[model samples]
Target chain A: MEEKCTNVCQNHLTAVGDALYVIGGKWKLRIIIALKDGHNRFNDLQRTITGISAKVLSTELKDLEMNGFVKRTVHTGTPVIVEYELTGYSDTLHEVLSALGNWGTMHREKIRAER
Target chain B: MEEKCTNVCQNHLTAVGDALYVIGGKWKLRIIIALKDGHNRFNDLQRTITGISAKVLSTELKDLEMNGFVKRTVHTGTPVIVEYELTGYSDTLHEVLSALGNWGTMHREKIRAER
Candidate 1:
C-alpha cells in the first residue's frame, strides 16, 4: 500500500511538472488565447494581450512556435506580412485551459465573496 | 461575432491568469503534491520534492498557507512538532491538478515519440 501510494504520487508530481514547463509562463496562455481570438498580426497580438512588451512577446512567440503550439508564416510582398496561428496540436490542451479557466473563475468569485 | 469572441477570450485570459497566479510557481504544485503524498513535516517535504532549498520551500509553504491551500500546525511536547496538510479548500483544485497531470503525461509521450 505504501509503495503504491508513493508511485502514484511520484507520477502526479512528474506529470504536473511537465505540464507547468510547457504552459506555465505568464504570457504563453494569454498569447495563445489571443491568437484563438483571431489576432494574427504581431501588432494586433501585442494590442490584444495587454502589457506584453515587444521583446517579451517575440521571445514567447518563438518559444511557442518551437514547442509546436503555434505556427508563424511570412508573406513576401511589398510589405512582408507575418501572421501567427494556433496549430491543431494546441487543441490538445483544451482540457487544460478549461480546467485552469474554470478553477480561476470559481476562485475569483470565492475571493471576492470573502472580501 | 467579433465582440462576442473578444469577451469570451478576455474571460478565458483572466481566468487562466488568476489560476496561474495562485498555483503557477515553480515549487507550489510540487509542494502541494508532496503534502498530498503524506510528507507532512518540512524535512520530509524537502526530501520528497527533491532540489528545493530550505529557503524556497519555506517561502512556498508560506504562500500556500496564505492562499488557504495548506494548513500548518504546531504541537508542543518534549520536542515541538510542526506539520503541514492540505486544507479542505485545496480539494477544490483536484480537477485542475488532474487535468494538468493527464495532459502532461500525454505531452511527454508525444515528445518522446517525436524524438
Candidate 2:
C-alpha cells in the first residue's frame, strides 16, 4: 500500500509533465492555430499549416486528443472521415498564440533593425 | 553576386529560426519570469528559478543577450559584477508571460479534476 501510494504520487507528477510536453511539442501549437477556423478535417489542417509532414500531423492529432486539447469525431460513412475541434481546455491557448503572433509582427521591424 | 544574395537571404531565414530556438530553450522562459521581479545578479536568477543547472543558466543568459531579450551590464570593481535586465524588445514578452501564468492558475483546478 505504501509502495502503491508512492507510485501514484510519482505518476501524477509525471502525468502533469507529460501533459505539458504534449502541448509543447513541435507542430502542436501550429496545429491548434490551424484548427481555430472551426472544425477541420485532417487534410485541411495538413494543408493549412505549412511545413508539417503528414506523419507528424497524425501523431500530434492523436496526442492532442489524448491530452484533451482537441476532440476527434469520426463520421461513419462509405469513405469514413475524421474531424478535429478545439476542446474547451484549448481556448486559453488561442490567447497565448495571438500574443505570440502579435509580438512577431510588432517586433519584426525592430528585430531586423538590430541585425 | 546572385549566390551571395541567396546566401544572404538563406542566412537571414536561418538566423531568425535560430533566434527562436534560443529563446525557446527550456530554462529561458523560467529565467525571464524570475527576472520580472526587478534587475538581478547572476546568482539571483540561479537561485530563483528551480531545477536549472549553473551551466544551463550561464548558457541561457548568453543566448538571451545574443537574441537581444536581455542586456548584460558588467560593473568592473574588486570583483566584476554582471547584471541582467530585460531590453525594450523584451517588454512584450511580459504580457505573454502574464497570460500564461493566468491561464496556468485558472486551469490548475480543472486539470487536476480531469485526472
Candidate 3:
C-alpha cells in the first residue's frame, strides 16, 4: 500500500505552492489585511499600510483583483470614490490568518528562547 | 471599550508579517518541504526541487541554515556526505503547513468555480 505520508506531503507541497502563488510577496497579504481592517480607499490604504508606494500598491491590487481576492468598486457622488473590498474569502482567509499568527507567535518565542 | 476587532486585526497583521518574515519568499518554504520530504543530500535536493540552480540552491540552503531552520551534518566515511535536517519547528510548522494547504485547496476550487 502507498504510504499515507507520501500523500500528505504531496498535498502540503501543492497547497503551499498554490497559497504562495496567490499570496506570496511582501504587499499582497498586507493589502488584504489592511482592507479587512477597514482601510478601504486608495489614500487610506496607502496611509495605514506604511512604507508602500502608490505604484506598488496599485500593481499589487490589480494582481489581487485578477486573482479574485479583491474587487474594486467605484461610487458616483458629489465626488467619485473608489474603494477596495474583499471577495468572499472569509472561509479561506480566516483560518489561514489564525494559523499563520499562531506559527508566528511560536516562532518568535522559540527564537527568543534559543537566543 | 476599545474595539476588539482592532486588536485582532493588529494581531493578524503582526502575525502574518512575522510568519512571512520567517517563511516568505519563493524558495525558502519549497526548500524546507523538500528536505522534510526525505530529500536530504545536496544533489538529491537539487534534483528533487526542479528548476533551482546549484548556486541559488546553495544560497537558499545557507540562508535556511543561518535562520535555524536547517542544520547541515557531515558524515565522515569513505566519502564525506552531508545531510540537511530540520530544527525543532513541529509545533509551529505542522499547523502552518496544514492550514496553508487547506487554503490552497480552497483557493484553487474557488478560482476554478469562479471561472
Candidate 4:
C-alpha cells in the first residue's frame, strides 16, 4: 500500500512537471488567453496583452506553436500578414484556465483581507 | 460590447497573473503537491521531490505559507520539530491540479507521437 501510494505521488509530480513545462512561463498562459479572445494578429496580441514587448511575444508564440497549442499562418498579400490561432488542443486548457482564474480571484481577496 | 469584452479580457489577464504570482515558480506547485501527498517533514519533502535542495525547499515553503496554501507547525519537545501541511485554501486548487495533470498527460502523448 505504501509503495502504491508512492507511485501515485510520483505520477502526480511528473504530470504537474509536464504541465508546467508547457504552460509554466510568465507569458504562456497570458498569450494563450489573448489568442482565445480573438486577438489573432501579432500587433493585436501585442496591444491587447499590455506590456509585452514584440521580441518576447515572438519567442513565446514560437514556443506555443512548437508545443502544438498555437497555429501560425502567414498570408502573402500587399504586405505579408501573420496571424496566430489556438489549436483544438489548446482549447483543452479552458477548464484549467477557469479554475486558475477563480483561485486567483480568491487568493487576491484573501491577500486584500489580510492587508 | 467591445468595451465589455475588453474589460473581461483585462480582468482575466489580471486574475491569471495573480494565480501565477501565487503559484508561479518552478517548485511551488511541486511543493504543494508533495505536501498534499502526506509528505510533511522537511526532510521527507526533500526526498520525495528528488532534485530539490534544502535551500530551495525552504524558500518555497515560506512562500506557500505567506500565500495561505500551506501551514507550518512547530512542535517543541526534547527536539524541536517542524512540519508543513496544505491549508484548506490549497484544496481549492484540486480542479486546477486535475486539469493540469490531464493536460500534461495529453501533452506528453502528443510529444511522443511527434517524435
Candidate 5:
C-alpha cells in the first residue's frame, strides 16, 4: 500500500511537471507581458519585443493561446490583422511577472556591481 | 546607422531572451521553491515534489546548477550523500515564487468555485 501511494504521488508530480513545460518557456512570459499593455498585433509585438524571431514569436503565441494564457482574434479588415489579448490565466501571471521583473532589476544591479 | 542600432538592440533582447530560456523551465521554478525550504537531496526532492521522474529531476538539477540557481555538494562521511541548496540567483526567486504560489492558491480557489 505504501509503495502504491508513492507511485500515485509520483504520477501527480509528473503531471505538474508537464504543465510547467508549457508555461515555462522562453518567449511565453514576454508575450504575455506585452499583452498586458492591452491587445497587440503580430507586427507590433515583433517590433516591441526586441529579439524575438518571427518563427519563435509565432510558435510562442500559438502555445500561449493553447495554454489559455492568450486569445488570438483575426480582424478581417485591413490586411486580415491578428491581435492577441490576455486571458484570465494570464491575469494571474501579471503579479508573478512583476515580481520577476523586480528581481531582474536587482539582479542586473548586482551584476554591475560585480564587474 | 539606424539599421545598426536596431541590430544591436535586437542582440540585447536576444541575449535577454536566452537568459529567460534557462530560467524558464518545467522544474526550475519548482526546484527553487523546494530549495527555499533550505538544503534538499535527490530523493527528498523526488518525494516532496509530487511528480518528477528521476531522469527529469537529475537533468533539471544539473541545469539549475549550471545556471547558478542551485549548488550541489557531495558528503563523503557516510553513504556519499549529495545535497542541493539555493544560490544567490535563487534568493531572488523566493519572492517571485511566493507571488506565483499565491497566484496558484487563488487560482485553485476560483477553479473550485467554478466547479
Candidate 6:
C-alpha cells in the first residue's frame, strides 16, 4: 500500500516540478502579468515590471519566447521597432496566475495575523 | 494612462513576488505535496519526495513550519518519534497545486508537439 502511494505521489511531484521549471523564475510571471494588459516593447516591459534589471528582462523574455508563452516581433520601419506579446498558449496560464495571486493574498494575511 | 497601468501592474507584481517568495524553491512544493498524502515522519518524507537531501528537507520543513503551512509534533515515547503534518492553512494551497499540475501536463504536451 505504501509503495503504491509512493508511485502516485511521484507522478504528482513530476507535474509540479515541470510547472515550476517553466514558470519558476523571479521574473517570468511578473513579465507575463506586465504583458497581460497589452503588448509591450523592451523598455516598456522593464518599466512596467518594477525592479527588473534590463539584462534579466532581456534573458527572461527570450526564454519565454522559446517556451512558446511569448511572441517577439520585429517591425521593419525607419526605427526597426521590436515588441513582445503573450501568445495564445500563454492564456492557458490565466487560471494558474489567478490561483497564485489569490493564495498570495491569503498567505500575506496569515503572516500579518501571526505578527 | 500608462501611469495608471503601472500602478496596477505594480500591485500584481508584488502579490506574485510574495507568492513566489513563500513557495518558490525547488523543494518547497515537492515537500508540501509529499506531506499532503498523509502525516509523515522525517525519513518517510525523505523517501517520498525523491531526490531531496536530508539537510535540505530539514531546512524546508522548518521554513514550512515557520510559514504556518506545517505543524511538527513529537511523540513522547521510549523512541521519541517526530512527525510532520500539513495545517489547514496549507490546504488553502490545494487549488494552486492543482493549477500547477494541470498546466504542467499541458506544457509537457506542448513541448513534445514542438519537437
Instruction: Give the best candidate by TM-score.
Output: 1
TM-score, model 2 to reference: 0.72
Of 1 and 6, the candidate ranking higher by lDDT:
1
TM-score of each: 0.94, 0.72, 0.86, 0.90, 0.70, 0.89
What lDDT is reached at residue B106 by model 6?
84
Interface RMSD of each: 2.7, 10.7, 4.2, 2.7, 6.3, 2.2
Worst 10 residues of 2 chain A by lDDT: A1-10
What are the Cα lDDT values of the candidates? 0.88, 0.63, 0.78, 0.85, 0.67, 0.84
Candidate 6: clashing residue pairs, number: 0
Backbone clashes in model 1, listed as residue pairs: none
RMSD of each: 2.4, 9.9, 3.7, 2.7, 5.7, 2.3
lDDT of 1 by residue, A1-115 (tens): 1222388898998998898888887889889888888988888888788689999999999999999999999999969989899999989888888988999999999999998
User: Residues B11-108, candidate 5, lDDT per residue (tens digit)?
Assistant: 43444455456566667777665666542877777767766799999999999998678889999987797989887767666666666566655655
> In model 4, how large is the Cα lDDT of residue B62?
92
Model 1 segments more than 4 A misplaced: A1-5, B1-5
Give the candidate order by descending TM-score.
Answer: 1, 4, 6, 3, 2, 5
lDDT of 4: 0.85
Question: Interface Cα RMSD for candidate 6?
Answer: 2.2
Q: Please, what are the lDDT tens digits per residue for candidate 6 over residues B1-115?
A: 3443556666777888899889877889888888887737888788787788999999999999988889999999979989899988888888889998889888888788889
Q: In DockQ, how does model 4 score against the reference complex? A: 0.56
User: Candidate 4 on A7-101: residue-level lDDT in tens?
Assistant: 77788889889999889978899999888788888878888887899999999999999977899999999689888999998888887798888
Error of 2 at A3 (Å): 38
- Chain B TM-scores across candidates: 0.92, 0.73, 0.79, 0.90, 0.77, 0.90
**Candidate 2 total steric clashes:** 0
Q: lDDT per residue, candidate 4, B8-79, as tens digits?
A: 788899898899888886788888888888989998898888689999999999998987789999999869
Stretches > 4 Å off in candidate 3: A1-7, A113-115, B1-5, B112-115
lDDT of 3 by residue, A1-115 (tens): 2123356566777778898888888778878888888778888788766678999999999998987779899999969989899988543677777777788877777778888
